[model samples]
Target: MGPTDTTHTTPLPVVLAGARGHGSWHLANIRRLQDQGVVRLAGVCELHPLDETELAAFAAEPPEQSADFGSLLDSTGARAAVICTPIQTHAELALTAAARGVHLLLEKPPAATLTDFERILTGVRDAKIACQVGFQSFGSHAVPAVRALVRTGAIGTVRGYGAAGAWVRDDAYYRRAPWAGRRRIGDTDVVDGVLTNPLAHAVATALELAGSGAAHDIASIETELFRAHDIEADDTSCVRLTTTSGLPVTAAVTLCAEQAGEPYVIVHGDRGRITFWYKQDRVLVQRAGHGPEETVHGRTDLLENLVAHLTHGTALLAPPHRTGAFMRVVEAVRNAPEPAALPSGAWHTAPALTGDGTRRVVRGIDAAVAAAADTLRLFSELGVPWALPTEVSSP
Candidate 1:
């Protein structure tokens, strides 16, 4: 079908895959957009039927629900699908949808490996359907503004880029699903770690700010992964990616934090720096001979972006091709040795923010993360006492 078939006058038919957990966010957004007459929620693919309470939210008219993705897409005649299934299932589900000539809003950490990512990329290309990878933060209006500044030399000669995110995830988080905190489940790679999953926006947005979202733009990646919790994957990690352009982008993030805070990316330059708190769509611009300029930006909804592309030839943001570099980082994490557990002296169990629970908090992760971003050093190379340097690189 073409834009003429999906004109603004006609609401695009879209289906939701995996409509529980984080998929609920898509449900709410779809319903909200549905009210505006831009799109319609045609069906849902879930392992089990949604309960009465869950079904009530779609009160406008119940959407078709089924366990089989292919059947759901065929029956609904949906033109697009949003895949928020587990990390390991992304490529499989995406290819399934693409085969049906369905566009996609695939969730972040698009696939567990670069090979899987490329497979999904090739499938979408061959199908000739739009696929918007869900790096929602890139939908922020501030992102383009920041990029324009870098392109026009508003940030001066760019030296490097860095992003920092320190957040708390309780033990219950891992138990929520079988795949949580796992690098590999059986033979399939999950790679669901702090860097690839929860704080992934930080990593992807940093690469965007550095103008290195394409896989070819990445020259090498050096990673120091560590875990403070008992999970299989790293909960706290740092990465230094040197782009083909010779610019470096560093990302330091933790699921175990002493104090939880917003995640942000910093654009470092000789003149000054630009700090973007991506979650809040906030920006801080500091340049030579100018007062600090800050603004909270509005965001473009990715779902609307997809529909606009189909209906009005609007540019698709966060497509799979733009996420190749981020996938390289995921591939590196997947192939890296099992993360080293932090020494007892380096961590402590803090009383949970809620009643009668506990969470792991690295003693000095906050400062160390800042130091790594500021100095372009990995935790081990930065001289943290309890840290031992273990670096893995990918060409």
Candidate 2:
């Protein structure tokens, strides 16, 4: 249906689930939508009771609180639901929302497993309800321009790309939450770590730039996960992939960095290159014909874009469907074996170190570096078109 046809004449009331933690971000965003008259604050569904101070913050009349999803939906008279639950419950909650004929704005890593992710997709398709995944970067202003450059061959025939980011998390950080770095939820070991969490944006961006069709035919993927900390899942990972169109893409993510630095991705072609720096909010472009360097800043208007897409079938700048490619890569990475065997050192000697350190670190930094190099070399040997040294400079 066209956007105008779907646009609610009156503000549609929205019920928000998972009011604490990340859910609070959704609450604030919904409030912004309400302030703009895009949607009305119907109610909130949280596992915990709302304190008096929190309740008083709502400008709209206080909404009913319900622990149960069905009761919550009934109590609020909400037409749509925004779910920000833990990774494990996303699919079930989304399925429940779909069954209720409620549209959805679910957080990233839509489901713990590919099967569950597909199930949610099937539910959305079967129910004919509008569902948008939360990959905020997809809504960035630079996306269209970047896509245009790639489509128009501004970068010439896109040959390859690379992305990297360094994020630090201490033991206390993982201890703060029960599900911080786990690979499995219940019997299913779903890979949801740095790759699925922080680096998801980079993966989505790569797929978007590479185009949807190419994403559908991934050539190969190699990944290494490092449990460098006291987390059940890998906090550090590196992946190399080749698209069906013969374009190479590599991404490295870490929560074990000593310090935080900018996260960046660069796409290269015969004609030129385009680089995106997430931390700096800048895009640098260089072409064969152009002199010096040109840079542009990005302003992401996700909420307004989402509202427009919902109200009027306006083309979505970033749709949840594009995430499937990223999920495939994530699955491959989680399934890949560790590049090196565990160290022979006494386990007790490294108790103070992080989980991955005993094995990935105690063996020494040189060993870690060699293992990483070997992993990448194997990817290249496997026919992944990783650029030779002369093609691009390392970050």
Candidate 3:
């Protein structure tokens, strides 16, 4: 968003698509790296151009802003692009960038459907371009550290992997975007549910810890989805998957938490268990014959990692293929019947913690989510009163 630093080696020309909303974060990050002589903010793609005031924070001189993404990339000679657009548009925009041989840092929930995921994946492969999916947790050093502890039997005989995300969102959250909390926007799938959009890192990182994060590594999936909010998507949901090696990985998440807190993934083992807070790259271990230990690990920012990959040939942290198993979960949710709306008796409205508009909170959901992860059980299996039977999928 600022002038390119050409005092040293030329910075990689980078275009940012959807330069508002979450794209704002990408814009600021580009400016940070731009100041450090890593990447230049070459162009910005937005539906409506940012006003002078809106663009004032980072853009010393406004980068080329245009609604036409492909033309902007071409005009700016972009070497890479960061896409933070709606979930449904990822494939088309990614392929457009790939068509011009631009590398990419595409945002999470790469596409609404696995078909589109494979389509874009194949195109990027055919182009031989580096495409990084924005699952930033995968960039954390703690991931490998947890695996190392497991391998060393610090947790001893991995029993299962469980992740829990309990977050709170106000009613305004769904109103912020046309596709927010939506399953499908007409025939085009949006799939903006709790597990797919907001807390997706929990699911992806859990599968990664289970060492089952590829399509072929996952054998089956079971999902129990429920909505406390009056949206077309689920705000409370849990998914359990069996790896090809017979490991169970489960994630239970909710946007209707009574009290917001950090989400965590736990490695359950026969001897003891390890807990990881992926966002913070922090881990805690309690194993047999050892007192509890806590550690804070380093993390590579995905965008910076992508830049390093292009300029220095560093390995991409979250290549599209590594997210295939998560996409499989998304595909299962897409094909499953609409999430059941919770009965009136099941949830109640409460004042938002931020004191804005109220958000629906499912009664006792915080415990339910934690229980599902701790036990690797579905909500129904936990005897939750309103939970419906899970829909299971096998490939």
Give the TM-score (vs. native) of candidate 1.
0.97
- Write model 1 residue lDDT over 187-287, tens digit each, in one string: 99999999999999999999987778999999999988999889899999999999998988999999888899999999999998999999999999999
Q: What TM-score fits each model?
A: 0.97, 0.81, 0.96
Error of 1 at 257 (Å): 0.6
* Tens-digit lDDT track of model 3 for 12-34: 88999987888888888888888
lDDT of 3 at 206: 96
| Runs in model 2 lying further than 4 Å from the true structure | 1-9, 213-215, 292-303, 338-395
Model 3 alpha-carbon miss at residue 250, Å? 0.5
C-alpha positional error of residue 194 in candidate 3 after TM-score superposition, expressed in Å: 0.5
Candidate 1 deviant stretches above 4 angstroms? 1-7
lDDT of 2 at 148: 81
Worst 10 residues of 1 by lDDT: 1-10
